[model samples]
Target: MKAAIFKGPGAVEVGERPEPVIQEPTDAVVRVVLGCVCGSDLWYFRGESPHAAGSIGHEFIGIVEQAGANVRSVRLGDLVVAPFIYSDMTCPHCRNGSTISCPAGGSFGNGTIDGGQGQAVRVPQAGGTLVRVPGSGHSDEVLRSLLALSDVMSTGQHAAVMAGVKEGDTVAVVGDGAVGLCAVLAARRLGAERVIALSRNPARQKVASEFGATDIIEARGDEAVQAVLELTGGTGADAALECVGTGQSIATAAAIARPGSVIGIVGVPHGEVPFTGTFFRNIGWRGGPAPARVYIPGLLDDVLDGTINPGLVFDYETDLDHIADAYRAMDERRAIKSLVRVGGI
Candidate 1:
């Protein structure tokens, strides 16, 4: 088997590794069909993530190659989406829709489990973590979209949902990366009347519009704030999604929303959140590493039904042998998202 590993800053390598097998009764082996790099992976690729140099991907969809005796929710030959983290669905936290906080949950490539960007990998808590899509086979396009359900789309939806986006509420998405663009789509799907996307890149702005962004702000800082405020008729957006995970983006979310609005942080925050006026303004802050397992089931239906095309975010695809280029494509911003085909599932 071959899997991606973090070598150092600006480096990733695809190399051979031992094949994974059912190591526990709760485990299942997944034959990864499609996998994509994530923005969070940038933290590692750029030497920004503290813990690097491990198996390096977490978002993917695959076919069930084998299931442990205790796993019952899926069986051999089932197509499934594996969220970024593995959690026992039976846990109280998962039952209440917080699988990310499940006591026994853990992320892939975190030293305990191999990451998903490989030919095959072992999945823990298979019954609770893997969402079995209804079908036998699907198109490459559909598979790519279903792959988004594992993380990118689900994370974007979580940001909107946490921000309390309502039928008439305005949404300001503070980033133009794949997650942020998907946030625009998610906000609209949830019925937001307006979606303001903060992006200076012409390409991203275009995709943001296609995804449902009603407005685009090309400025940054207070200038961006004023733009969002003016666009919303001076009241500001009802909710803002900070999808870049930078202090500046978070600040924009804090400054661009109306008082008493919610600001969701879906980006993996890199620095301290400036809790200054944000605390005094009664502006609620919500969302963190999304509980992707909880959101995938419903998002799966949308993808399967063709109601959304979040996969548009993926602009590059390659086989596992070219995985290094996949990382470079994302790091250089050559592609909004890069997909790695593991096998012909």
Candidate 2:
């Protein structure tokens, strides 16, 4: 078998690796059908992530080739989506709908767990972590949307939920990456009356509109903050989703939110936030590792029913052998997200 391996910063290669087998009673060996590079993957590739060399992917969808004796929710031949984090559903946090932070859960691609960017992956807690896809024959578009259910889509939904978006509320989203674009869709699906997106990228602006952004703000710095405020009358948005983790983006989210509104930040923050400014304005902030495991089931239904189409975020596609190219494209900002076909249905 072949897997994407990270040798060092700015380095990823498709190298021969051991095939996965069911190692636990609750595990399932999945024949990966589709996998993609995540923004987080860039962190490791750029040497910014703390984890050392290991398998390089987490977002994926696949067909179950085999399952351990205790696996009950899924079986052979089932097509499923695996969350980036694997969790035993019975844990207290999982039961409370915070599976991503499950006390026993851990990431799948850190060399401790077989990563999803391979021909096959052994998924622990299969019964709780895998969401089965409904049909036999799914188009590329459908598969792409289903893939989003694994992480980005659910994370975006979490951002909106945490931000307190409500029916008739005006919402603003900071950043135009895949998560931000998906946040636009999530806000729309959640019933925000007006969706305002802050982006200067033409490609992202187009996708944001398709996802239901009623307004696009192309300004930066104070101009961008003023633009969002102007769009929502004299007040800032009722809620704001911060999809970028930079200090500047965090401030932008806080600056563009109404006095009593909340800012949901989903980006992996790299530095300290300016809490003093946020405290003075009375703007609440919430969000961390998105409990994508908790939202997958409900969002899967929406994907199957055509309520949303987030696969549109995958603007580039390639084979697993070309995984390096995919990373380069995303690193260069030439692609919103890249999909890699690891195997077949």
Candidate 3:
């Protein structure tokens, strides 16, 4: 087997790894068809966050090569999507809509477990962690979109849902990364009449527009906040979504949200939130790691039917051999997202 190895900050290499096999009766071994570099991975690549020196990707869709005796939800030869984290869907936290906190859950590609970046992965709790695609012979475009459901799309939808976006509500998304762009789509899907995307990149702005953004603000910090406020007639956005975890982005989201509004924050926080200011303004916040397992089932139909094409976010494509290039493209900002074709269906 072969996979991407995270040697250290600024270093990722393609190398041979032991083939994954069923480790428990509840496990399944998946032959990866497609994998993608996530924005969150950049945090490790840039040395801004810590990552172990081994298998290191978390988003992928593949075909089940082997299923354990206890894995009844999916069987061999079934195409499936593995969320970034593996959770026991029966756990109390999962039942409460917080799969990320499932007592028996754990993240993939955290150094010990075989990651989706590999040719195959040993999926623990496969019955609860893997979402089987309903049909076969899915087109390339559709497969890419399916891969997005493993993380970005679900995370984006979580932000919108947490913020209580409603029909005719004005929404402002602060971030133009793949997740942010998907947040725009999620807001529209939830019936938001107006979506303002904060982005300075022309390519991202185009995608945001296609995803249902009604406005694109080419400003940051105070300027961006003012622009969102002016667009909302000085009342500020009915709901502000923070898709970047930086201090500036958090502050911008807080500033642009209307008083008494709740801001949805899904970005991996890298800075402190302005609790005092938001409290004083009657602004609340809600959001964390998206329970992708919960959202995947709801979003799958949309992808299969082409109601949305979140795969448009993958601007760069590569194979497992050049895994390093996949990381570099996203790290250098040359691609919004990098899709890695791992194996055939």
Candidate 4:
């Protein structure tokens, strides 16, 4: 099998890896049809974060090629979406809506695991981890959107869910990456009447607008905060979704949220949250890596129904053999998100 290999900072290569097979009674081997480079993947690509030197990538949608005896929810030939992480939905944490914290759960493409970037992946806890796509003959556009449900879309929804976004609420999103853009869509989907997206990139701004951003602020730091506040008539947003984990991004989120609202944070934290500042304003914060497995089902329906086209975030595309180019495009910001076509349906 061919897959993306992490060769340390600033280096990603397309190389051969062992093809995956069913490893457990509950396991399923999925032949990947679509995979994409995540913003978080850049952290390691840039040496800002640590990643093992093997299979890398976590977002993918595919057809089940093989399934162990215990894998009943998904069978061979079924198209499925694998959440970024694998978890037993029966765990206490998963049942409580925190699959990321499931004691038995772990992420894919983490060096030892069969990553989604490969031709196939061995999915553990297949029954709980893989969501089968209901219909067949999905178009390329729809398949790309289905891949988004594996991570970004679900993560964006998590931010909205954590921030308590609701009907008639005004929301502010602090990031313009794919997840942030999806956050804009999620806010609107959750009935937010006004969505303020903080972004300086014209392309992203366009997508944000298309995704239902009622306002676009092209400022940064305190200026961005002021802009959001001004848009809300100085009362600040009813909710703030933090999709970037930088100190400035966190501060901006804290500053722009209304006193009684909560901020949903899904970005991998590279900086600390302003606890004191938020606490003083009676604001709250919640969120982490999205429990994608839990959100995929509902989001899938929307993707299949054309209610949301989150796949628009993927402006760049490549095949498994050119996986390195996919990573570079994203790292250079030449593409908002890079989609890697792995195999045929």
Candidate with top lDDT is 3
Query: Candidate 4 regions off by >4 Å?
Result: none
How would you encode candidate 1's per-residue C-alpha lDDT over 1-345 as one tens digit per residue? 889877788878888778899989999999999988988887778887665576768998899998999999999999999999899978788899999888878888765578888888899889888889897667777888899988889899999999999898889999999999989989999999889999999989998999989889999999999999899889888999999887888888888988898898898786578777877888888998888888888888888888888998998999888888998898999999999988877
Q: After superposing candidate 1, which stretches have Cα over 4 Å from the reference?
A: none
* Clashing pairs in model 1, backbone N/Cα/C closer than 3 A: none
lDDT of 3 by residue, 215-331 (tens): 999999999988888899899998999999999999999999999999999987778899999999999999999999999988899999889999989999999999899999999
Each model's TM-score? 0.97, 0.98, 0.99, 0.99
TM-score of 1: 0.97
Name the candidate, 2 or 4, with the larger TM-score value.
Answer: 4
- Misplaced by over 4 Å in model 3 are none
Cα lDDT, all candidates = 0.88, 0.89, 0.94, 0.93
Ranking by lDDT: 3, 4, 2, 1
Q: What is residue 130's positional error in candidate 1, in angstroms?
A: 0.6
Residue pair clashes in candidate 2: none
lDDT of 4: 0.93
Error of 2 at 137 (Å): 1.0
